[model samples]
Target: MMTMPTISNQNGAFPLLRKTELRRLLTEKQLQQLEQFCRASSKRAGSTLFRQGDPADTFHLLADGMVELRARPPGRRVYRTVELIGPSCTFGDEALFGETTYLTSSRVLETARVLALTRPAFDRLAANHPDIALGVLRCAGNCLIKTIRRSAILTQAPADVGLRMLLEELAGGNGNGAPIPVRITHAQLAGVLHVSRETVSRMLGQLASEGTVEVGRGIIRISSH
Candidate 1:
């Protein structure tokens, strides 16, 4: 039996819902009319929005907050960590582009405000907003570049190096600066490295022992020293 979507009301008069499946989450008609795009219906904190290999049936416009994109390894290990995408970003875009499913999993780091866009609605907007469409194309290109870089890193670099590269990206460079908060689990890290979870735990322990990084519950911090 098909399950009905649940709806909740909070922070606004309208209710949050997962219904309207296969419909455009946003409409060009609404945009052309200058009506507010869907209001912040709901917020998610430390939530997994989608999993790797899941069907890409919807797209999302992040109003605020961070989203991490992770990819599962080739083996049977269940974890993945490819990259982290920031606010004002569009994700779950494969549904609009091609037959491909969601290539990566997206997780929300904190309370996030997002607008959902179904495929048809996205298509209509793309038809009218050539500039916006091109912009999204560019973003997709950037996503591809990051994906390729991650693949190369894991294929050639050691686990520590892979972990370092992740830290560098998160820290936004400048080794002397404070390390960014990495909100992920060791199992996820292992998936990115295609290594065992135990290996990741051990490596992190070694780093902590050497004063290279600090570990916390649901957070990892790299040391500037």
Candidate 2:
């Protein structure tokens, strides 16, 4: 719980969320309505944005840098990182629904710019601007869908399959049935897959022999087909 620095314009105008999935869900006027409640903050690494079980009174969007969302299990001493959120992603949408709390804590992984919309502010906006409210809900719904989809892939797919899917996602696909080379280490892949470094390296070697990927140093170039 380090100190946090925040900046809110007099008019409450923050346009940084334009890069998020929300931008597609909201019309220009609806987006303006939502922005009127925005408060921006610059947080250093190690800053705690919110904690598990905290009253979910604010929704957050990362305008820049990264944050780690983590949770401690009932008997665990250390928190496990569940996700690494990047720019334009919204989180803590539990605030948008009534009487809910955060399931995990968010910590700044890098110096970050965050935009927050408080519950009270959102309440007022919802009352006066239902269209905007609905738009925000739609965006949150889409996020939930992606989370469910990602969970399915991680839990249901085999290790090598899951790794391939993850690589495709990170590579962002080259659109012509090819994957752009991505720079990442075996340790990073192991952390995400909840496997060991040796396991990731072995899988990569297998994939290389199969002509599925070429791994060198710290990068992986996945085959198109």
Candidate 3:
């Protein structure tokens, strides 16, 4: 069993988590109780946080930086990125509801500060605070529903349409007028879009020529005009 480290106020981890959506659902006293159950860690880019099939014993919250959730279908050679979790997002929430194993692996994409609560601690919290537990469950359920809808919509679309939709989503639906806030590579985009890297590159090139977008090293920006 993995042991949780003692939490302290010196690291200022509580204030960081307080700004996340999770905090909105929890009262100040509940938040303080939550802090008691969490342990903080700093991870470097490229570090694997957890792997699919691993025991889902902890739930994680990203206090800073980014992480990617990826999955390798059985017998598949390459992993597909299912989601890119930014700061203030929580992952592994399923563990709180009795999930035994992780469905996807998570990797840090940048230097990240993370706070995690063990399943035992979470169960205790849920047992003691029904309101907080209900709120967290609702939040997790909504996120799961959104992810399901996005996957269903994207998978049913033609590759080109899916690609465009993805780009728009990354741009926060600011139309084609705003630059995508995140830097991404063609291969990474391919993984998310479930297309070949060559296909992604060729399509991007076509979009560039048509003045729909501009692609550069590790970046793709939608044109305002």
1 or 2, greater by TM-score = 2
Candidates 1 and 2, the one with greater lDDT: 2
In Å, residue 171's CA in model 3 sits off its true spot by 4.1
Error of 2 at 174 (Å): 9.3
Q: Give per-model TM-scores.
A: 0.67, 0.73, 0.78
lDDT of 1 at 48: 71
Model 1 Cα shift for residue 1 (angstroms): 14
**Residue 221 accuracy (lDDT) in model 1:** 82
lDDT of each: 0.61, 0.75, 0.75
Q: With candidate 3 superimposed using the best TM-score fit, by how many Å does residue 168's alpha carbon deviate from the native?
A: 3.5
The runs of at least 3 residues in candidate 1 whose Cα sits more than 4 Å from the true structure, single-residue gaps closed, are 1-42, 51-55, 61-64, 68-90, 100-105, 113-116, 173-179
Cα error, candidate 1, residue 25 (Å):
24
Off by over 4 Å in 2: 1-13, 167-225
